[model samples]
Target: MDIDLTRTDIIKIVQYAVGGRVSLIGVNLSGLDLSKLKLSSVDFSFACLKNVIFSRANLCHSKFQEVDAENTIFHDATVSE
Candidate 1:
């Protein structure tokens, strides 16, 4: 299923991931800011993250399997396997 989320909604979801994991599978988040957010262990498998800026964001242990991340920026972002 395709899911659409507003910026505010995305922020809320990231906040909710503070103590756990947030699954954003198959969600289209093209051109979103997504900067400076804490998103540890988040699942973004198959999500469309084109042109999304992840500057300074904490994305440790997050999964981006098969995600469409063309032009996505990860400046200063933390990521792990």
Candidate 2:
């Protein structure tokens, strides 16, 4: 609940997740502003994305496998597949 992450550093998280063959599994990303980021193909299974803003972000082919997407904003975000 107190995860302090910056936009620049978030790619590290994503890379770590993917590198480890895991991604956003049950992560509490509440109130995060992930807008206009290159987050394509990242897995979000069982993650908590409450109130997260992903506006205009490139989420193409990213997995929302089992997420708590409460109030998550994907406005204008590329979310194909």
Candidate 3:
């Protein structure tokens, strides 16, 4: 299952899902404000996260392969070791 989402809507949705588990696979969230959100175990492998703001977002166990992250903000994001 896949859904099309805009930057603003995606941010809002992600914000609500913060501190909880949510799946955002294949969602187009390019250039969105994803900062201050705490996501765990989410699979964003093929999502368009280009220029997306992930500053300070908790991305533990999250996947980001094949995603366009050029110019994206991830100052303090945490990835799997």
Candidate 4:
């Protein structure tokens, strides 16, 4: 199921996430601009990220297993592992 989330909603999720780890399994984040945000250590397995913008965001150690990330932008983003 696709979740309709605004930037504010996403921030709330991140804030309450345990130990900077976000579980985004099977979540659809298509067309959402999550630029310049701190989203490190998020698990994006089985997620749909079509057209999602993650420019300048911190994404180190975030997992993308089986994710659909077509046209997703990671411009100047920090990513590792």
lDDT tens digits, residues 30-75, model 2? Answer: 8889998888877778888889999999887788977889999999
Worst 10 residues of 3 by lDDT: 1-10
Give the Å shift of residue 8 in candidate 1: 1.7
- Cα error, residue 23 of model 4, in Å, equals 0.4
- Score residue 67 of candidate 1 by CA lDDT: 100
Candidate 2 residue-pair clash tally: 0
Candidate 4: what lDDT?
Answer: 0.88
Candidate 2's C-alpha lDDT? 0.79
Query: What's the CA error at residue 51 for candidate 2, in Å?
Result: 0.2
The per-prediction tally of clashing pairs is: 0, 0, 0, 0
Mark the 10 consecutive residues where model 2 has the least summed lDDT: 16-25
* C-alpha RMSD of each candidate structure in angstroms: 2.5, 2.7, 4.1, 1.6
Residue range 1-81, candidate 4, lDDT tens digits: 465676787889999987778887888888899999899888889988999999999999899999999999999999998
Q: List lDDT for all candidates, in order.
A: 0.88, 0.79, 0.73, 0.88
Task: Give the runs in model 3 whose Cα sits over 4 Å from its true position.
Answer: 1-3, 6-20
